[model samples]
Every structure is written in C-alpha cells, then in structure tokens.
Target: MVTSEWTGPFDPSSDPEELTHLLSVLSSFLSYRRHAHYNGTHVRRQAFYSLPSSHWSLLSRPPFSVLDHLSHLDDLIDQHAELAEAIFRVGFAFLAPKLDSEWIGEVLGGDARVVVGDELKVYEKIMDRLGVKASKNDVDKARSCIHQFYREWSAEGAVERQKCFDPVIRALEEEFASRARCSPNLNLDRSEMSVLAPGAGLGRLVFDICRAGFTVEGNEISYHELMASSLVLNHTKTAGQYTIAPFALNGSNHLTREDQFRTYQVPDIHPATELASHTLNSRVPAEERMSMATGDFCVLYSQEDSKETFDAVTTVFFIDTAPNMIRYIEAVRNCLKPGGLWINLGPLLWHHAAKPPPSEEDKNKDKEDRTTDANERDIGIADPGSVELTNEEVVALVQHLGFAMEKHETGTFETGYISDPSSMLQSTYRPSFWIARKK
Candidate 1:
C-alpha cells in the first residue's frame, strides 16, 4: 500500500552520499521546467540567428518558407514545453512533500536563499528548499525517463509491450498448465507461484504478471525509474488521469510537427483496479500480490537465502546490462526453484561492450573517489571487471549453470524500445526470446 507521501524505499539519511544523490534527483524534477523551456526556445532560436539577415529574406519565400517553418516549429516547441512542465509537476507531486526542514538544510549548505521568480510557485519553493542543482546529465536522464512512460504506461506502448512481454507471460502459464494436467483433482495454484523480475523498469511487466493471476515482485536499481514507477503504481487513481508529451524534446526525424508533439495519457488502465481482482481467489493479501524491491539485482537476490525462492524468473531486455553476463545467469539460476522457468526476451546488446578499459589511476583511486566509483557501479558502467559475450555463448552459459533450454527463438519478433511510431528513423531489435527451466 502507498502512503500519502512516498519517503522512498530506503532511508536517505543513513548514507550521506546517497542522501546527496537523492536530493539531486529530486532537484532535477524541479529544475526540468526551466531546462525544458530553455532547450525548446532559447537554444533552438539560435539556429535562426545563425543564418545571414539577407538570406532570411530569400529563405522566407515560397519554396523554402523559413518563416512558416519557424512558426510551426515554435508551436511544436510550445506543445513540448507544456508537456515537460506537466511531467515536472507529476514528479514534484510525488516527491516534494517528503522533504523536511532538516533534510532541506543539509542540501542548502550555508545560504538558504535560492534566486526567485520561477513560473511555478511550488517549483520555485522546492528549488529554494533543496538549494542543490542537478547535473546536466542527471536532468537529461530525468527527461529520458518521461519517454519511458509512453513505452510502459500509455496505450501507444501496448503494441511494443505485447511483443516483448506476451511470450514470457505465456511461458509461465504453460509451465503451470503442464503441472495441472498431471494432477487433475489438485490443479496447480497460480496464487502459490511467485515470480521475480530483475531490472523491472517502470514495472509494467510486473503488473502484467500480477494481472495474469500470479504473485510477483519487481526489483529495480535506477532511482529515476523507481520514482516514476512508484507514482504510477501507487498514487494513480484512474486511467488517463496523467498526460505527457513524450516526443516533445526529441525533434529529429519527425515526419510531421504533430508527430513530434504527440501526447498520451499514462497508465492506460488503473493499476490497482485491474489487479484488485487477483486477490479474490488467492491466499495472498491484496497488498502482498504485487511488490517492488529497490537495489542491485545480483546483490539482493544472488544469496543462499534467495536460492530456490521463486517459482519463475523473467528478464526482458535486462540480462545484457551485466558487467559479467555469467553473474546474471548465476543470479537467475540461484533465485529459481528446481523445474522453475526462466523466461527471457532481449538481444545481447551488451551495455559495456564498447567501453575501453579503465586507467591505472582509476584502478587505484583515493578514498574521496569511492562515492564516484560506487555511483558508476550502480548504473552498470564498464569497469576493469566488465566483460562482453556473444549471443550463442550466453545461451551456452545459461545451460552450463544448471538450466535446460526448453524453447529458443532467434530473430522471430522485431521489437522497439520506447520508439515513436510516426518518426522517420525507427530503431528496432530482433531480440533473442527463450524459455529455460532449472534442472
């Protein structure tokens, strides 16, 4: 169950570095309105300034029609700006009230005064309280996270979710169906089946599994995703209550201005309403049916107590994020019971494949660099410990680690990750989809 205000999954005050990072993340959401407007208007207007004064006269005419194009672009940018503002408001609504004066003072340093005159009063107030600035990269990541909402919660994302999630859901149902056939009188209880989804970003897959009549837990490492997912899963009261312009910031490859400025209502269905029915036939309490865990997947689940803890494990576009793919396979193997299914759908797009080796200096960094080092490891950035493997080798390693391949399909389904359908440039992945059972 969700509280009136989410304090977050862990106590930020426990670790000074982590507390600072959390405050930065919260500040990013508050700062996003200014960043979005600046990027949309000021930065883009510079393009027009680049052309010569006389050249504008010729370009503004019929064939080129620079003036008309500029007008249309301005409208699109405005539309996007509005959407960015909405995202910021939603983020603030979930996070801001949790801040107390003591927590705010830590981030404020000495002077508590923040330069005034932000458009949104609430936005300015939080900015003043935190008195910390989000890095450019962190703010950019916060913007990218908005696009993820369209992929995971909006109706526009349903097709992509169907392609990526359907097979895994089916595999779980089929596994239990087979068991049910053997015992006609005592059919397998799906309520007893517990599934784990590591790297469960935004939690749509985990919610889908719960809707499919099984108890499931989603484990996430990214704070951005956790914040976004928590808002949708816990605070949301109805379908289409929240609206966001996903394509507002992304301007290139747009077939039309309308396409670039497209908006969508999030959580096509109410999360709680859809899953509330799952409790009627189950022994688990309504709250226990669905849960989210925050932390590193390997560290949290790759222990002796976690061994054989879940009836199934599901990974969607997840495994390749590992520095060593073997550790991911080992973790999955460790968590599942004997004969438990490990359903996976993803390409081996190794996140750290292109990263060069770390410098000798980095290998022997001082104590002050510990915070930076720990942050790098949290995001799965390539380190001296990182390794990359081929698709064939990954399947082989899963088998070697006590899992038997029951189904394997390569290049069968072409999937898109947070893709804008109307955009001219489409990046699609023909992911490796498979189901393997623990021996």
Candidate 2:
C-alpha cells in the first residue's frame, strides 16, 4: 500500500488541516492524470452521464477497473452535450493560457452539429499534427480535434507542471536525503559529463540535478515549455541567494519582482577552468546556453556522426514516442562514448507498438489479430516485439550494445495514481529509471 509522506516545500506539521487539504488536492490531481477526461464537463455532459451506472461501478475497485470505468465513460462522452462541455472545461482549465482560442471556437461551433464527413476531415488534420499518418478507409481513425488537443496538452505538462509537482520534488529530496545517509556510496559528487536533456519540458528534474551541482544542457521541443523552464530556473537561482522579507507597514508581502533579480548562476564546470570561463563570457546568452533544437529525436540523433561522443544522455518519457525505437536506441548508443552514461526516466510500457513483424509466429498472429486488435497495437506498424523494448529488454539491449549496467531503480512520483486513492486508473506499469555506462 502507498504511504502518505510529507516532504515538500510546505510544512505539514505546522498545519494539520492544510496538510489534509493538500493531500486531497494531490489525490484529485492524480485522478485527473488517470482519466483526464472522465467526469469532465464536456465528457459528462456529452457522453459519460448517459453511460449506465453499471459501467462506472468498477471504478471503486483496483487493477484494470480504471480501464473498465473509462471504457464505459467513453460511450457516454461520445453522445451527451453536458459531458462534452465538462470535457472542454477540464481541458481548458488544464491548458490555461496555452489553449488555442481558434481551436476552442471550432470545437464549440461543431458541437452536436458536426457531420460524419466533417468530423473525418477534422480528425485527419488532428492526426497529422500528432505526426500520425492515417491511411484512407481506416476504421481506427483519429480522434476529434478537441480530444486530440486535450490529450496532447495533458500529456505535455499536467504531471510535470511545476505547481503540480511541488510535492513530488519534496518527496524525492527526502528520499535522496535518507539514502545519502544510509548508503554513503550513493553520495558521489556530480560527474564531469554534461547531461543533454532533449524535450526538456519544464526542466523540473534538470533543475534538481543542477541544484545538486551537475551541469545540465536542456533543449525543449516547444517554445512554451522552454519559456516555462527558463522562468522556473531563474526563480530557483535567485531564491538561492535571497531570503523572504517580512511584511512592512502596508502588511503586503515585502517580496517584489525587483528583489528577485540577480545575475543568473550557470553551472560551474569542474577541472575545465578555461572552458568554463569561456562558456560564461561567450556571446551566447545563458538562456540559450544549451542550443534548443526543434524536431524529431530520430532526426536529431541521425544528424550526429560521432559514436561514443557524449558523457551522458538523458531522456524522460521519450523512447515510447519514437516512431522507430531501434533506430532511436542505436543512435543514442552511438552518441555515448565508452564509459559514458545513459539515464532514462519514464514509463517503458508503451500503449502503442513501434515496429513491424519480425518472426513467423508474429506474422501469423498479426494477420489473425490485425482486424480486431489494430487499435490496441502500435499506431504506426506491427513490429514483432523487437522494436519497442521493455525495461528488462532495454537493459539487455544496452548491455548488448556495449554498455555496462550501472544501476536501475523504480520509484513513483507523488503526482501519480499510486498516491491518489480515489484515482480510477492508477498506472500499473512502473516507470523505470536506468543508469548505464558505455563500455
């Protein structure tokens, strides 16, 4: 059973009531993560409300019950106007300033009035935006624009968003603090290698590592995410040098935006004093210190010619999204030098498949199951379990690719369903954390 442990920025002991409230909020947040559209204004109104109560009964249970609840909810969400509105509201709240006004207008305009043909057109556009190539006459077509937007937005930042992850950060700090005391060996200082975080959404983990004195170079795939990470990093660096001032005569919080301004502190490179000094004085701005590349990971990896070049490579929730997992993995392996490290933190259990059939058994099964299981399989092609490697498989693959296994650990973030008892679909698949060294 998951335990409730307080270890974040907020002082739990100072106010028991506030702690309870925080826990409740965290639980609600996790529920949203599991079935982001469930009970949403749009979903409840359009379709979920009409679903038989029997369909949602499994939500009260465990294991695959969340799936059952969502399956039932999907039917109601497909039909009811109220449910659709609820979904829209939930999605809007999550997306906030990022929700495109034009998209919202189109969704509201098409509500209940969209023709099958129009829906198909909108669906195709949405799929294209998601990098999904849809074939004509495919029954497992793209979801509506509204659905696609919500899913993408939710996946991008909901859990990783700074505000939502405050507790999670605290929990990790506490865990590390305890481990540092018990396992002295784990207390090694940051290595000389620089970490390249591609698609570094919000940079929460990156910031943490930097605070621990590691040099991190982050490249966000989106502008919004890059801006957010910059803002947060600036705040963190400033906070380190200043203290909160007590309210003056006006009784307003004395902290002002001006008080927060300070020269941003970039990571100090050890042993490379000349290079470090040059990096600091270089014309490239601190925000742009790490060159941000916007494009697909496979393309980015392919452009590089060196094998065993970097000291370390980090990817979070990235491998599962790769169109070609083997190619991606091979590229990553090539990028690392002998003794270089590759650290990945994400759910390895991809919901979709990544490659094509490779064996006789798979070929026979693919033919038989293609019709019924198409949607359940990989979105691109039927890869015979060789493309998307499982966590164990990944470890083995890395070893086979000439990497020495250093460490592997699994831990749940507080933002996940494991901490939220009310969540219907708590992820059963554990997020794997791997640390491997190139041989």
Candidate 3:
C-alpha cells in the first residue's frame, strides 16, 4: 500500500502544454464511440488548450457520459472498488509522463513534440479520493480494459460477434441437443440445462446461451469488463444507447466506401434486441434466464454445492486467456456432471507465453489479452516457458480426463467489432466439442 506521502522515482512536474495535449487526446479517444460529435464528426479531435476541474462536466460528456447511461456514476464510482481502482491506475497512466511511451504514442497520435503526461504528483493529487497504489502492471491491465471495452459489449460489436462466432455456437448447441436426448429427464424445461461459461468476458456468450433456451451463469475476473457487462446485461433498460467502442479507423483501407474522415459507422449491437430475438426463449427474458458471477475461473466452480455440476460448459475465445491451460481444463472437468458437454473455441496460444508471437504487428495489432510488455516477454524462443500445446494436445488431455470427442473443427474467421462493419479481426482457432462422463 503506497501511503499518501509515498513517492516513486518518476518526476512529478509536467509542462502545461503536455497536460493540455493529454487531456484532448484522451477526450477525443473517448468521444469516437459516443453519439455526440466534435466539430460535427463522431470524434472530437481538437486539442484542449486547458483543462480545469470546472470543465469536467463537458469533459464528462465524452468519457464518463456513457458510463452514466450504463452504470450510474454514483454507483459505479462510489460502490464498486474494482472500477475505482481501474480508474485510478489508468487515470494515473493518462496523466503520468511517458510511461509505456510506445503504446501511449500509438493511442495519443504519435507526434514527437507532444509531451506525454508523467506527473505522478499531479496524478496522485487528482486521484487521491480513490487512493489505491496501482503499479505499472495494474495500470496496463486497467488501461487495456477501459480503452477497448466498447468492442465487446456495444450494440454494433455484438452483431458482428454473433456472426463470427456462429460456428462455435452451433457446435455447442448441437452437442447440447444430443445430450438432452440421452438424458433420462428429457421432460425437463428446455431452458433449464445448467450451463456454465468460465472466463465469460462481458457475458455475451452467457446471454447468447440464455436466449437459446439454457439456464446460464457466466464467470468473469476482470473488474473492468465485469463492470461494463453487469450494467449492460442487468441494468440497462434500452440497448444501443451506450457507446463501448472506437479509437481509430482513419487511414485503414478496410473501409469499402470513403467518408469525410475515412471512417464508417460501426454496426449497432442491441443487447435488448438480443434478448427479444424470436429465436431466443420467448418464454423467459434473457435477464431471467442468465446471471453473472465475478471471480477467477480456475477456482470459481470448485466450491459450489458438491452435488451441483453443469450440464454443459462453453468457453469461447476464453481458454487461451489463462496462463496455464491445464488448470482450466481441470476446473471445467470438476464442474461437469456425468456425460456433460465441454465446448471450447479460441486460439491455442497461451495468453502470456506464445513464442515469437505470430509477428510483431500481429501481437500489437490484436491486443485482446496481451499486456503492454507482451512483445518484450517473447525473448526469441520457438517456445517460451508458458504452455504452448497444440489443439490435438489439448483434446488429448481432456480425453485423459474421461471425455469423448463429439465434434470439432479448426478454421480462421474474420470478426468485426470496434465501430465499423468492415473493421474486423482475422483470428484462427480450433472449435471442439466433447461429451465427458466422470469415470
């Protein structure tokens, strides 16, 4: 715990110009995903000449504006310790000078003369109310979530995500159907199958299953994503009103048609629409069918009522997020009832230790779970200390846990998110389904 008087080696004094530049850059970055406009464009691009506590409400318009519509500011800031911690850490980063210079440059427009905020003293003073001493790693973790949060839970992002994940979802549903047939209690409510998705970032998949007529509960650890997902899933009365995305689309040739600023409106992801979809269980609203549990995946399901086990477990783009794959598989196995289905979809690459990282740009380009120093961690090895098992190895390990393969496929899919229909990520991963009965 850093005391109030504690100080780090970093200098505190920053140029007024740098502070102004930082404020404008962060404000503009926040604006892009909003419905408002800066100079009549989706994003406010002008630099801020000065920023004082008085202008905060106007500043709040672009950044904290959407948070209000989602999670009321009083509740989010005052109640949730995790969100407050994230804000404090990232807030420090935003104001601190030249920390993670390369990444900050990328986010702040990379102008050589632009001074990056590094004033720890100012940051501490500004962030004193939320007095948590967040380290560099903490700042990186928080920044990644707050910065790119829009892409996962936003209206436009959901539509694109559903399309890209069609295969994985199909596999899970098919296996679920088969399992339902074999169960003695086929008479059970079709939506009552106990489904668990660990590392369920933003609860999109959890709600997706609920819509498909399954009783689902998602587990998420990242407080940042949890805060956003909880508000969107449980609190928001209307969807598409919130903005969860858009930092940059300029100069990227992915746009099919030219616009005033080389940008296209990202598709709207309607969370409400997802709930009311005719295909979803019309009998129960999504909120009634699903819930979110916040905790680490590795230990989340272990302490449940010893008799309680899931009918199926779905992990999409999830398994790889862990430092070690074995613990995740073991945890899934522990949570399963006899002959329960386990569906997995995500790249085999370990979150921290993939060797040489497909490419430098590839690593940084797709910054889903990668830390700021992810590239530096890959010290020129064909394989790093982290587990880099092949899809086949993963399956074999699960089979060793007494699971039998039901269906599987490997392929690459381009999923679009982050504010434009054409803007997408081309990621390759294997999708697998297996029925396991405890031996």
Candidate 4:
C-alpha cells in the first residue's frame, strides 16, 4: 500500500479548500507523502508501479478481463503503488517551488528518522511560508487530480499517448524533409528539433520524445509534480532499479484464471532503462536531452527568448485542465515557430464552462445545493465535468486561428484508475486529436 503523503498538486480554481487551514493541511499532506520507516523496514510508497489486472474471462471471448497467469503480492503493490506515487507527485509539484534542491533533497530524500508530530511541524512551517490559510474545500478540489492520476500519467496508459503523437512525429519529419527539398541550403540532419510539452505530467511523453532524438522541454506549474518528477528522475539510474514500489488488486477472486486468484507482481517498469539505449547515440544523453521547467505555461515563455522557436508544441490531456482553453490555444500558437507543428490530443472538457443555463420551466423550483451535509442529502459529490467542445468544433477553432489541419482522428481510449486487471474502476474516453501546422 502507498503512503498518502505525496502525489497531488495545488489547483485553487475549483475551490479545493478554504483559506483558513490550507497551508497546515498542505504541510500535513506533504509530510505524509514522504517515505518513512515502518517497523525497521524501509517502505517506498513514493515510487509508482503498475499492477496487472486479474480477469476470469481469459478462457472466453477476446475481451477477457481475467489473467491466465500465476500469482505474487506484486500485483496488489503495483496498483496501490501507482496511486500512491500519483498522490506523492502531486505534493511534489506543490512543494518544489517553495523549497530549493538541497532542502527538498533533505526532506523527500530521507528515511523515517523522526515521526513525532511530523505533520504538525510541516503544517506550521508551510503556514509560516505561505502567509495564508488553506481551507478544506479548496484542498479537496485540488485533490481531484488523484481521480485522474492513472489516466494521464501511467505506463499502462502510455500506449494511448503514443497513439496521439506517433502520427504527428512522422508528419514533422516529412514536413522538415519537404522544406529541405525546397531550399538546398536548409539542412535537415544538421540540427535536432525542439519540442515543448506544457503541463507534462510525470514526463513519460517527454521521455518518449527524447528517445526519438528530439530536444524536449517538459514544463509544469505545480511544485508537487516538479519535485516528484525530479526525485523519480534523480533516483532512478537504471531501468526498474527502484523496484520496491509493488502493487495488488482488490477483486482477484472473481478471476477464472486459477493462478490469478492470488496476487501477482506485475512486470518491471523500465523508465530509466528506456533512456539508457538512447544515451550513447548523442553527446547529450537521452536523460539529459529531456529538460523540465517549473512555471505557468502561459507566462513562463512570454518574455523569454524561447518562444517562437520550438519546432513542435504538443499537448496531451492538458488543455482541458486550463481555466480558459482559449488562453492555452493562444499561448500554443504564439510560442511555436512558423510552419511548426501544433499537436493536440485530449477531450474538450472546458474547466471554466459555466453550469448549463436553467430552463424556464424549472425556474420556479430552487435547485438544491448538491454539496449539502450527509444528514441532509446523499453522501455524493457533484461531478465537475467541464464544458468542453466537440472534437469537430475544436478543430474548426484551430483552423480559424490560422492552423492548417493535416491529420485528425477520433477513437476511444481506456484508462485504469487501479491496475487491478479485474477491478471495474477504469474508464474510457472518446476523444479527438489534431496535428496542424501554423499557416
């Protein structure tokens, strides 16, 4: 099981917490996110590992939910580890800006040395630093990232991300080559292309791009994610080296695969190893090729020399998180070079879409406050679905903004909340993607 201390970022737009206890709670959350000693054994709840799904339909049709494999406690560890890591990273992104490298290394890098009122101490320190209070609702709203952890930032879900960009990468190469043909002086192979992936969660796509031999910068606004990612990247020298993070599922009993009835440790995660193969190819190792910056996507490059020079600007499941999707689109367009690629893959769930207008027929009836207490109403929170556009509508907007649509696709991608092959918490999104060039 993962320690809930780390793995969430701060986003106050949706009212996660009130102002009063926010910093204290944040400190408490960060304290727990760090690893601690339990009964003299070191537990690494920070590192995320994927758990295998255990389904019983292995003997049945193509959509077998059961695993035909054997068992180990590793399966349970993986799913839980993944969730733990996500939460931990969220805190990492939050704390990164407040603490410098050495201080962070000291806090997040230690064993469970002192456990006395650690949360309180952390909270007081945070309150002192922030000079403000953090309410529970605002904190709760920020906590929503947990529900999205697996979908946007897990290895199992990575293939879906690949689907979004592989086509664009191919197009980029073709476009560059075509341009070179027009001007003999233009050298296609002389320089590496640069890409900017804003709000890059956990940097998996950033790594994938580096492996493909591009210079990439992954930008994040959250200190939690930035710190967590930095920690993961710094500690993981070899692929699968940090194997302590394990996983298991909740309902393995339903699986028909006799062996899967027991928990099984999934395969190893080789993030660092993936970079190893590409390291030798260039003077800059693959790991070095992938850079990260902590700041807002809109203003981070607004005054810098970095804008208008990137060969590509890629966003995956990112724009939907924006307070205003238009701002993100405008930012993307401004930063990319002329003829550069703007590759976007995500749903149109607009974070700032107002609730649907009340109908005249229902005007007389006062709508109930859905967040009423448990005694007054059912103990369920309202879904914060965004007011997003249809894929078609979004593409039209891009075209109007001077982008030439080169490719588009609509398909379904399933993302698992837990790695349990048998659990039913996973979800599928019917989303659209576009690969357009600035005309």
Candidate 5:
C-alpha cells in the first residue's frame, strides 16, 4: 500500500522551478477537502434551508426526507475528503527529500515543519500554514485526478483500454513484423524500436506499449496528471493497494447513494510486477524500456535532435488539445523516422473552439486565479489562434504533411472518456482511428 508511512526515492537539491511546480500540485491536493466541503455539502444545505416551508414540509414527509438526504451527502463528502487527505499526506512526504528547511520556510512559511525517518511527514501545526491557497481550477483538476485513476489504473478501465489501447499495440507489433519479412538487411528489434506517446495521461497506454517490448516514452503537459501518475507508477507497492470513491463529489444522477459513493481499487495490476514479468521474458531492464518526457509536444519534439528519432508515435484522444493542429502534425512528421508509423485515435473536439465570453463572476475569479493558471502553462508554449478542422480535413492535412495513409477508420470505435458506468448521464465519442507512415 502507498501511504505517508512509505518513503519514496527523493533527490535533495533538485531544481527550484521544478519544486515550485510540484508544490503547486501538492497544494491542490491539500485544498481538495475545502473545495468538496463547500461544493458538495455547505452550498446544498444552504439551498435546502432557503426553500419555502410548504415545500420543506412536503420533502420532510414520507420515507425520504430532504434534510436526511442532505446529511447523508455530507457524510459521503467527508469520506471523500478523507481519501484526499491521505493522498496529500503521502504526496508531501514523497516530495520532501528535494525540499530543504529554507525552501520550506520560504514556500510554506516558517511555521511549517518536516519530520523525517521511516516516513517524511509535514505538519502545519501553527495557525499560519501553507503560504498559498490553491485556485478553483487547481482543485477541479485534483478532483479529476481521482476519476483519472479509475480510467487508467483500475479494473473498471479495462473496457476502455481494450477499445482504445489494444488496437494501437497490435498495429505496432504487426507493422514491424511485416517490415522484417519484407526487407532483408534492414535491422530492427523490439529493443531498438523506440515509440513515443504524446499526451499520455497517468502512463497507462505508455506502460502497455512498453510491456509489448518496445522502448516507449510518454510526454505529458499537465502537472496534476504528472503528480498523480508519479504516485501510481513510482510509489505504489502492490495492486489494489488503495481504494477511493471517485464519484462521491457529484451527488446528482445517481440511482442510489451506494452508486454515488462507489469505490474502486486502484492499479488493478502492480506496474512494477507486470513490467518485471516483461523484463523476465525479454531480459531487458525496465529503465531502458520506458521513460517519460514532460513539456509541450510541439516545442520538445521540434528540436533537431528529436527529428526522425522515433520508430512509431501513438496518440489517443490527444490531438484535440492542440491549439494549432498544423503544428502538432508537423511535429509528428518531423520526429518520425523514414517510413515510421503514426497511430492516432481521437475526436477533433478542439479545446480552443470558439466560446462565449466569461461572465462577470468568472472574470473576477480569473483575476484571482490567473497566477495559478500561468504557472501551469509556463512549462509549455501555446499559440493563440486555433485551426479547427473536420475529420476529413485532418486526414487530408496528414497526407499533405508527407504521410501515406496505411489505415483509416472513421466514427467506428464507440468509446467513453472518464465516464461513470452507473450514472444516468453518459457521454460517448466516435473517435477517428488510423495509422499512417511518413514517406
């Protein structure tokens, strides 16, 4: 089990900028309780009291009482808050090695204290605690991190993984196998085959690809995701070691209270054990088999050294995050070796698609939270103008960028993104699936 009781591998005297980023993530996890308390309990209780007496009387009668439901919801929120607190406790300890007393005093205030030994624990015993308060956006991202664990590391995610990751794995193996037979004197081995997965969330697909025997690197831009992924990939000791109620915060659209408070065991399989099994078969070290790159895909891979360095690139539900689709396409083209495979499966739900201006309240919050948002974006660069395109248009653009289409399937795979299985509301997408080779 991963807990505050377990010490992680930490490096002292790490980069200050990197520590700042990690602290921001830690603050978000720390703030989860307050965020959920207001949104899940206090606000609803206020609305319940604001209702007219006649309406209240009607709700007060029968087997179901509105007040009782509200109280029960508060209980659920408390449970969820406990889970968040546990995550924050361990996360702090995990990152404590890189932090010195001076740095802690500067960032977390002089009142903050660190206890090291079997467990590296932090205590904010004084009235003055952390110097910063996590913004609403940061808290929201932290909440999503819980749901992401279900999507990436739990048994519940197997259905989605089969629909999304399995095809990419099969294609990568088959394509290279075919190449081996077709070209004599051309050298290729699983150890030598380097694959890149941009926008890898929680490292599931990347881990799967590595288990398939190819050396893989996952690139991610979100710190919330990176922090959560680090916990699961690096700190976890066994499968089903942790349990969390991912759906507890959202009270509506549940068939029952149990459904709303459903629990799932994380990391259905221990990553280290599974990877070790692969290592036993291949006789290759895990470090050489998998890695992670942190930064914007375009900026990082556009460098001359990264050009034509990968044998294959896998992108799943990632391309839509791009502001300029052309920049993404160009980066992929430039990074793949001659005739290297490009596998993509996602809908073009452009993140920068036009939207209405923010309301006055939203603008006020933006003013207060802009610094947090800026820090999140500092590691990566983004262009302002978004070039939105249809599915056919994207395929044509891929071809224009010197990639020959090997396979293309449109609106065929029905998949869900971080969806709750038992909820009344379910959103599914018919993502475009295809493989192309750079000529």
Candidate 6:
C-alpha cells in the first residue's frame, strides 16, 4: 500500500540522469549527523566517491562507459535513495509480512530524498528480532527465521525482488562477456565436465553457467538457499528437454537429475579456532572431501590439495568476507591444478580494523585473550569501509598467489536488482570480475 511516484522517466540503461539522481540522494542522506557517524564507523568510505557531473554526459558521446558521472549533487542522492527504498520495501515484504503499510512507513519514514539514521536504527532492531547474534541459540533461531522468510518471499514470486538484479546482471554481462569470450580455453561446453558453485545463493548465476554447457554441482551454507536452488534447477531441467538443442546447453541448462546436485553441510563452530578443526572432523578427510574447496576469491585456492585435481573453481562476492585473506588465497592456490582457472566476482577488499583494547569486563583471570579474540569477535567482524587496501594492493596479492591474471573488469547494474545493491554499495562492495590461471 506504500505510494510513491517517479518524478521523471526511469531508464536503467542511461547513466547521466541516474548518476545525478544518485548523488543528490546520497548528499541528503549524509547531511544528517547520525548518518555521518554511521558512515564513519560502520559503513565503508569508498561508498562515497564523488562522481564528476560531466561523466554522465559521456554516455551520449563515444565509448559509452558503464557508470555515468553526475552533474547535480541532488541527482546522485536520488539514485541512491531510490535503491535504498527499493531494498527496504523488498526486505520488509520478505521478512515482515505482518507489518502493515503504516508500520512500514514508520520504519522507513525519512527525507523522501534520502534514508535517515533513524531508518538504520529501525533496521538494526529488525535484525535483532531476526536473531542475528553470536550466541549458538540466537544464531540458530535467526537462521530459522531467515530461511522461513526467504521461502515465503520465493513463494510470493514478487516481481520487485526479481527486478533488483536487472542492473547488476546487465552490467556484468556487458563488461565480462568479451573478456570471458577471449579465453577459448575457459569456455565450458557440456561435453562431460562438472562445475561447482558453493554458497550458491538462489542459483541465478549457476543457471547462466549451466546454459554455457557445464554440468553444475552446487553447495550452500544455508538450507534455504539450497532448497531455492534445487527448485529453480528442477524447473529449468524440465523445460530444457523440449528445447531445440536438447543437450546443446544455453541459458536454461540444468542438472537432469536431482542427485546430480549435492549440498554440503557447513560446519557449526563455536569459535574461529574450532572452525578448522570442526570442519575437518565433520566432513570427509581433507584429501578426499573435495576436488577443490570453494571460499572467498582471495582464499578459494586451498594450499593442502594435490596439484591437478580441479578443472575450474569459482567464487562470487567472497573476498570481502574472508577474515584471513592471505591464508585463504594460499588455500585456493594449493587446491587447483597448474592450469585451472579461478573465476572471481565482487569486491577484493573487505575492510576491517583490529578491535580496540578490551575493557575490564572482557579480561578475566581464566579467559585466554586468544580464545576471546578468535571465538567471540573474529568470525563476524567487519572492517569499516574507511579502512581498505588500494586496488593496486589487491592486484599484487593475486599475483603473489601464483595466479596469472587473465581478466579483470568492473560491472555496475542500472536496475539495482542484480544482487543486494544496498549492502553492496554501503559496503563499497564492487563487482570486480577476474579470471586467473595458475602457473
């Protein structure tokens, strides 16, 4: 029942108008003192780079780039505001159906041009109710609620949720399509090779990979994600049967059998120290468990695996989340065959700074400092976006891992529908696609 109208024609393809709107909205949002505090402490700083106004007009000229620069500050603000509003609406619909229009408005009410700090406070409260906490009982409860909400949202088949990906996917396709095509060796056609997508949220990208002809095997950390992927794959597989090129594999390619797709159980660990131990014990032995272990891009290559087992490895939006980027990268490198390709999409740097000195309450006679740091705070800790590695540093890190960088490009969507745009933008999480082959 929420009502709002677009003041002008909304075009996802054009960048100038959108960029101007995006800046204006952002400025208004940041004008509030609370918003500035949150941005300084909780949000990443890279999220606020000012786009030149002339850049927007470049689209009308030659060599139209991916993102347009803004002319007016208000224009930029509008773009960001629109995206935030859409996310708030979709998230609310999925997670809080019982909330009436008035309650939703109350939660989201702010300057129409920008989100206020109050809005963020409301979001934090919702997250708390959803059970996003560190305690075992609390986390389990939160996971359950999240799973249920995702299921309900999927069932509703709301177009708004689907629309979110339009911008991101379009940008990705345009930026990476040519580079992905250049490497004929990486082109996966469905002769008989197996491809795996661990942490496959909703399986949207997996579906596209399957269409390119690789038999896909998917794993997820959440049961809800696994279920959603299964349902989508099932439908795609059935539909593909009647197509002109039955086995030719196009955009609709999927596993012919349910058993072909396997979901792995993500280990539950009380502390980071126990994560490695728990994973090792609960799953099959490291040597036999997987052809390759999928983690964040920086760490997708495992150091413990034999040299030539995996053909291809993929990671999406993982690098920013990894706690130990160096170790993780080493792990990924160790797992791959000499010539195997590592496909990565999303931000390279996940900003997180070391926590301040512990208060008296945190220091007890028996509590080990290592134990408290590793278990209590390390797993979910994120660096403020203000702290980040330069793009050069990120590139160097990849090269240091023994990968011959094959491709690198940036992608941005216009529709703001490709993934969680709010989280991506707020976190300064760029979609940086790369293909690296081991030497």
lDDT of each: 0.74, 0.42, 0.50, 0.52, 0.75, 0.38
Which scores higher on lDDT, 1 or 2? 1
TM-score of candidate 3 versus the correct structure, residues matched by position? 0.56
Candidate 2 ranges beyond 4 A from true positions: 1-192, 219-291, 305-309, 354-386, 410-425
Model 3, CA-based lDDT: 0.50
Worst 10 residues of 3 by lDDT: 1-10
The RMSD of every model to the true structure, in order and in angstroms, is 4.6, 18.5, 15.0, 12.0, 6.4, 20.1
* Model 3 misplacement above 4 A: 1-127, 133-143, 146-151, 154-160, 179-186, 244-285, 304-308, 354-385, 412-439
Which pairs clash (backbone N, Cα, C closer than 3 Å) in model 1? none
CA deviation > 4 Å runs, candidate 5? 1-22, 52-62, 65-130, 183-188, 355-381
Model 4 residue runs over 4 Å out of place are: 1-155, 176-191, 241-273, 279-284, 302-306, 355-387, 412-421
Question: Residue 18: error of model 2 in Å?
Answer: 47
Candidate 3 lDDT at 212 equals 73
Give per-residue CA lDDT, model 4, range 1-439, as digits (tens): 1112222232332243332333434443343323112201122122211222232233223444222221233343344344444444444345446456575345534435435557444434434455554344433333333323343345544555556656556655666577668877754541267888887765556656776667778887654455445544544443333322212222334444433233322212455665566664345556546777756676555444556868888887777676545556677788888988988776666655675555655443323533344433211112222356766777888888878998887875543333444443445556676789988
Candidate 2 per-residue C-alpha lDDT over 1-439 given as tens digits, one digit per residue, 9 for 90 to 100? 0101111222332456433332332222222322334333345444544667776555435653544444544443343222222332332233234436686456546456445566433433332333322222111111122122221222223343332334333433443455457678754333333455555654544544344333555544332343333333432232222111111101123243222111111221111222234443323322333333333454445444445556567776666665456665676777666666676767765645644546887677766766678544332313434445667877777788777876676665433321212223343445676667667
Ten-residue stretch with the least lDDT total in model 5: 1-10
Models ranked on lDDT: 5, 1, 4, 3, 2, 6
Q: Ten consecutive residues with minimal summed lDDT in candidate 4?
A: 39-48
Q: Count clashes in each candidate, considering only residues at least 3 apart in sequence or on different chains.
A: 0, 35, 14, 58, 0, 46
Q: Which segments of candidate 1 are over 4 A away from where they belong?
A: 1-12, 54-131, 277-286, 358-362, 365-383
Residues 1-439, model 5: lDDT tens digits: 2111221122222656555556666677776767777887789878877889888778877665767766776676666555566566656766566446776556444433544431223444211244555656778888888778888998998989999999999998897688777775765567677899999888899889888888888888776776666677777778987776777767779988678777888879998778777764244666567777766788778777789999999999999887778888889988999999999998889887863456788766656655668543322234445667898999999999899999999878698987888899999999999999999
